[model samples]
Target: MKKTQYSATRVDIISGHLTEVVDDLRLVDVADYIAFIRCELFGNIADIVNSATELTFYPDTLTFGLGGEYTLDWNTAPKVMLDLEFKNMGVNAYFRLTLGADSTEIDLHHVRFAETGRSPADNTALLAAAFENARLPQLTASENLG
Candidate 1:
């Protein structure tokens, strides 16, 4: 049997008015606009693991009665498969605003492990911090965009 692989779809953020140049203005003037524009970019990855256990075989052994000596063995063991879906909802918006400009790329590399029973609000803080850290350099560089 052939194995199956899944691919994530790419999402783009539109940069409508950012391309327009205003008269008598500097790049710093649009720093907030650029930050706001780029801040809209977001992505999500949903990971899931499915497992199953089952007892399939039983054998009767030596001195004891068949029922008493019988032992059970599991045929199927627990298995986990990682399924990841990537979304790039606003990447285009950020790229359009920062591309060709002296802006630094934001780094969003982290493996957040949520607790077994945690509320969405509980994770929001961590996520917010991660995002802030990722955008800090870009926001700072926006002031010097030429």
Candidate 2:
């Protein structure tokens, strides 16, 4: 419950699969969604996560995944989900972010589909969907967090 503040400049995203699509996504929110996720991770640690993140969209599905957990002095780490959707300029994408307990580094993965013809961005008008939820916030570290 710490009062963690957020800034858009903090979250940096580098797309591994489609730079053009990522650029389009940024054009819609101007990186607000990315910043919010970074804010959630930063809230867990006293300082911000300065590590560089490199994520790629699924070649087939065009979906991306990123997750990480911070070590907390407290007994348990909180689990939360933050989902985001962006629709603009013939681009649709979904982001699903989550935070849990016990981890040092962050990992980015491409969500694979069992079917051969599974495309996340099938439509141009808000057709793509990705979800991201981050819950690490140094929940019980400082008194201010309550």
Q: Give lDDT per model, in order.
A: 0.21, 0.30
Q: After superposition, how far is residue 31 of candidate 1 from its true place, in Å?
A: 29
Instruction: Give the alpha carbon lDDT tens digit for every residue of 3-120 in model 1.
Output: 1111000111111111221111122233332333245311110100000000110111001111101112365322211111111211111111122233222112222334435553
For residue 33, model 1's alpha carbon misses the true position, in angstroms, by 25
Clash statistics: count for each candidate: 0, 21
Q: Which candidate is the best by lDDT?
A: 2
Which whole-number lDDT from 0 to 100 does residue 96 have in model 1? 12
Poorest 10 consecutive residues of model 1 by lDDT? 45-54
* Angstrom error at residue 122, model 2: 13
For candidate 2, the per-residue lDDT at 59 reads 25
**lDDT (tens digit, per residue) of candidate 2 on 33-146:** 335445654332211111111232222233223432323345765443333232233333444334343321112222233334533333211222231211122334676665
Model 1, 24: alpha-carbon shift in Å?
A: 23
